[model samples]
Target: MQLSNIAHGPEIRDEAVAFCLWAPLHQRVTLKIEKRGQWQMKRLADGWHRVEIPGARPGDLYTFILPNGLEVPDPASRFQPNDVHGPSEIIDPTFAWRTEPWNGRPWEEMVIYEMHLGAFTEAGTFLAAIEKLEHLRRLGITAIQLMPLSDFPGRYGWGYDGVLSYAPDSSYGRPEDLRSLVDAAHGCGISVFLDVVYNHFGPDGNYLPHYAPIFSDTHKTPWGRGLNFDGAGSRFVRDFIIENAIYWIREFRMDGLRLDAVHAIRDDSHPHILCELAERVREAVSERPIHLIAENEDNNADLLARDAQGRARQFTAQWNDDIHHVLHIAATGETFGYYRDYAGDGAKIGRALAEGFVFQGEHMPYRGKTRGRPSTGLPPTAFVSFIQNHDQIGNRAMGDRMNASHPIEAIKAIAAIYLLAPQIPMLFMGEEWGSTDPFPFFCDLADELNETIRAGRKEELSRLPGFDVNDALDPICESTFRQAKLQWRGAIHNEPFVEYYRLLLSLRRKWIVPCLADARGHSAKYDSDGRLVCVTWKMGRSILHLMANLSGEAVDTTVPNRKDIILSQGDIAPDRLGPWAVLWSLAQE
Candidate 1:
């Protein structure tokens, strides 16, 4: 079995490198450390090679040598010399950590708040984000899921194009800034989850081919060629990736890693890279519980299934885009993308509650096949559901405002789905009080990689209707990211919106007893005509009914039992109102 090791180089000394390279077909592998003069190496066996390069360090460059004459550097190196075009550089993990040992909240108790740190603030540095941890904590969010911080080309991006796996993006401050962000977040009882892009590397900074065989033309993803996880010389490559996953949990003190686009990871292995990575992180965090959440669009419940003895080889959970599908269908009444299969979105919402999956193995007209399998027995905590996320917002032509499209009343209905439902609720940053920000897909690429990114973004958006190719590269100006920042002023002043979000978050934190039961009892009931759908939070004493008025006009709504007014986005908060008129009512038998 390949193990993790520490390697180093010059410019920085004794840098810790958890190195791995693809040399599977090769019986022997040699680690090479190159510096001022000639490079030196030591041969290793088991199709694996590892050694701590003592003198070599961060800013110093090095690569690996396989029996096949392939040379690569520590795949887990935080920094790469030559800007991802050259060998990997070591990064020391001994930076001062002030955050004491802190155990994170339960999966069911967690309210994940997703943010793109680069666009979350004006400065857009990790240090800048650190100043905002207390804000998220006060918002009733238990976890902060950050978009990718790994080094990508240029100043801005969606972070899916990261090339350097180990280092934090220079635009977001150095590695130390990221460490400070996580530590500070921990201090305020907020667990950090970095959305990691493992599917592919950025076009500009990517030069993995010169190091080892980590890319394969055989299996192409929607973005590009899939990672080389099972091919020849892939053992080391797999190790490099799996170790990088663990590096964040063990070293960076992150509570979890949100694996970006797991569906794009095509590996033909008996024990796939995903399984290996989960187990590796499990072992790495044996002393503390850490999460390895994958963002898989594959509506498969087996994606979260565990092995015997309750050891999860799969992901902790995935982003439930299906929830967005159902909510969008319910609110906007559109059936595009994977939402074509939803017969009744209100029922789909109910299915999300009862079964813990929205796309439950139904014939999906969008994919022309049965899409997700039924997850009847899984915990509601197995899925993170949200009405708006980066993908939903950024995929638009001008990135139209989410709250702008739907009525303020209907917007509250959508948020109530996640907060009231059993599934783990996630809020896109600025979603609480509805900050007017359009998170458009903007990236800064090197001059050489400009055409590559342009063509790639254009082709990807081409499938969508009426997508403008000219909009792919919107010019990565400061205004690009500036437009995405949250307007806390609006949230603070608007007592209604402020109280609305606070009420939802506080309500979720107060009554949603993850301990009472799993997501087994909740059932969604609604129709195609958009009349009424209900979210029933089943409890031992009282079952809560979350009713939504799909149409523009008020419609007569009914629940399982009597109701009372709890909250609403309409003109007046209902209190001691008639049965049908009560916007939010807590009732009993």
Candidate 2:
């Protein structure tokens, strides 16, 4: 098997360890293993430095020494016991067999539950997260998607601002603890998917800028400079990201990965970095199925399309922001910021249901340009839809969930659309029970960068009308982190929406899952005058219809006669629908 230069990070073999570092610009590099003194590294062709230490083993701490007498932690460190600035420790990659025969669950059977390890439980450790998996299993979640865990500088973060791509954040416990979580999740018949960021690194504790030309000034991102994926010294950078993807799947047994913000990954190279990454992952996993998802803001349809050879070009699914935007507008009737492009009406939902993206090649007034490609050719299962996620909820000035902004009936109606639709569905943590706790944007940053983050967050919130910039919660504050943690007991007992979610998920598995494979079998319609959105889905011989009234006032409407009434919530009459009434029935033709 061929290996990338970044693939070998302190590989322990037969009582000796081999260390490899790509330092083409530097004339000399030294391997400084703690307690073992320093050993000069031999410079190889193409700017790589290599050294073999006989006594080095799995638990050793090491750093690389430069000609200027400065020492830095390994860029591809597997474990950083002393945080991001400390020496990288050699961890035992070996684990006992438990989920060996586990081929992950099918993508078609997936109902994803997105979670934050720290915010999901009171203890905020991987083991603590394991204790709550049974609840998700009972809720009928087939997959769990965790936010980024890459090692960052501070004690708490959203995980996007990570410096070390290889190491799991030690704040979440040891790397072994993470392994146990995945192993346990598989034992419960749930697959684990990780969200990974490769567009840029965090500001603090990011030593790659000094060691190598790892970033480019050509393309700028909101967070930082874009990664140099197409310029000089880009081959190694591409390998670095591809290897990181494989490491998570091979080392920790992760079932899949969700690439964060691929629109920022600007690469003009022929075979795009995303395509190469997907191909490498497929090669690494061999015959075992692994899911690859992308969060593309541009709404490019080709991200999930196949090449001429019938090979998947990039990912299995792309996070469908259009669906969420239209639903949010219809539910809350707020047409500000990016929501202005979507009309807050029931017809928008019907359009999204029939065609994949309502904004397909249409000129977007908010951006003053065309935004998305035609996604009608793409399968509905190729898009992941959700009403609320971390970015949509937490990026708000108050970090309010959808349940907090809209009425209970409106929330339930939107929930039914997302869950029962042909597109893949994901639930935010604690969203099942409509938890009132705000998922505010919180991060633990060093003092030097604290004010910058605070000011940036405040400026972003200023775009929303009537929002007080001064009253926004500090992202760097400890209280903000505490406020985001889920109060599981309170939400489960007090919130009635929990039962709504359970019933929807049950119906999804029994009725909707079978029809997701064929996008043509689904159709939707809506009447603006009646304020009603109706969807009809045909699965083999079983036909199902879902009608929802999103208006505040009761709506009188004609109802088609159906024999099987699978599920009905709120007011459902033969010809009239009370405000926010959603009814699901099976029709015989």
Candidate 3:
């Protein structure tokens, strides 16, 4: 078989299969057909040659012959066994998907619910995640952004360290299973946005270096070797990564992709990988709109900017960590890592509302550098804001939640600000009702990768405020996933939390005042010494003022008594709410 000339994913003939092998010093390589037994083929002169195998179709198993004559499974196989040592399964992407014309929700309308497939349910499979879609839909969520599901080694993982780009993590079920989940999510009127990692591959089960020069030794990232986007003979490597992105969106009928850690892509090409990927994806739609949301930290609005042409350039949106860090730390009082820079009473929250980013060009004491660029024109909706996401909850030393860290009323106040703000609000899986689970980081890896992860996690986490790697990877024996599961019954039994969430969702749909910022003046006000904050949400013709106190002590102030009092934080504050107070009112006559 011809290694380089072998038929690839889309450009394939039924009878032709190109076998790829990386001997680095090999003269010639051949493919060994492993249908029941091994069948050797003749070698070519130029390191690769092709011969049509008449009967070898999608299901027939195959391996490649090394220059040393050792045979191994297809290193870049779309499916793999339980571990790296296991057999590589043949997968055909021609499975039926029901969400053919699913073109994702608009950026302004997205209320994302971030979730981990494994810990999302007891089964932790694609089918398992499907069972809870109705809850998310009824909760006013427009999209489901799943954590990385790229196939990785071992039993369970967070899916970020996925090694195989094209394969869905078999630990979470098969390729068809993921397709069914996306199809089912679309059926429930919820778009599925998958989180994909293109910056770097997982440490384990990564065979790209074995078959091709996919990783560049030129520059190193925190996650080891960065992808060889612009290197010698890097055409195939670039195509491989981009094809994988297209595969998930097209093959599984995924509505969009939340590209993980795009800031690390570090491509210096004229047309960057991100821009190229975006162009091709929209073109593939043929008439449908596809979404590409970047999980970027650069804070450069140009990442979502459009060129002279009116094409949909850049990503649909990006994950705004500053907003959450500022608001969450203000409410929960956890000032460890980046949260240390967000202790401006309610001024931080106010700033985030007026501008989508809180730390835009601010000197960050934590990173010891000024972070983010000036994004004066960007709308708040382009950045997904949340009081709690998987990263925030999981990074905790003991996996404690904001609820466990602060009074429930404080959490409610945080919730009110995010839901009432102009930006799209996202909720971690159990964040709505305030689940008590600690989303501690855990991963199942092959022994080689597992040890690397443990050591690497230790080194990386040492920089965090109080993270202990030993405590984080404690075998998941403490029912970490169970604790993270959304206690549906608690939605009713825990009436206060339930009501708080319901009020937010209801207002998100009905509160036209905050629905859109229009041709009017808008700003968030703070009390005499920055103890309380009041935001005026004004569209073209609608306007309402939302107020909340972020301090422990309350002060008497001239709150507008002329307007209609629409909503309050809780029953405890019939007269005045102290810790976490919220209210909405219009200008009185």
Per-candidate TM-score against the hidden true structure: 0.85, 0.95, 0.88
Candidate order (TM-score):
2, 3, 1
What candidate 3 gets wrong by more than 4 Å, as runs, is 1-7, 10-27, 36-51, 70-76, 98-103, 306-312, 448-451, 466-496, 512-529, 537-544, 560-566, 571-578, 585-589
Candidate 2 error regions (>4 Å): 1-6, 306-312, 519-530, 537-544, 586-589
Tell me the tens digit of each residue's lDDT in model 1 across 1-589: 5554532122243444334443445555566656443333333554344444444445555666655676554545576534444566555567777766677755667788899887788778889888777777777888899998877777678788888787777777767678888888888888889889888877665655654577875878877788888887676567678777877887788888999888888888768778778877887787766777877777778888755534345677778887777777766666654556664535666666556666677776767777778776565667788888899888775665568776666677777666766677888888887776788778777777666655666776776655575665353555766676666676676657756777788877766653335344333333323455555554445556666655555554343233355555443322222212224445444
On the 0 to 100 scale, the lDDT of residue 36 in model 1 is 42
Candidate 1 TM-score versus the reference: 0.85
In angstroms, the error of model 3 at 147 is 0.8
Ranking by lDDT: 2, 3, 1
Flag regions of model 1 displaced more than 4 Å: 1-39, 43-74, 80-90, 306-313, 336-345, 466-479, 485-489, 493-495, 514-530, 537-542, 559-589
Candidate with best TM-score: 2
Q: Return the number of clashes found in candidate 1.
A: 21
Quote the lDDT for 112 in model 2: 97
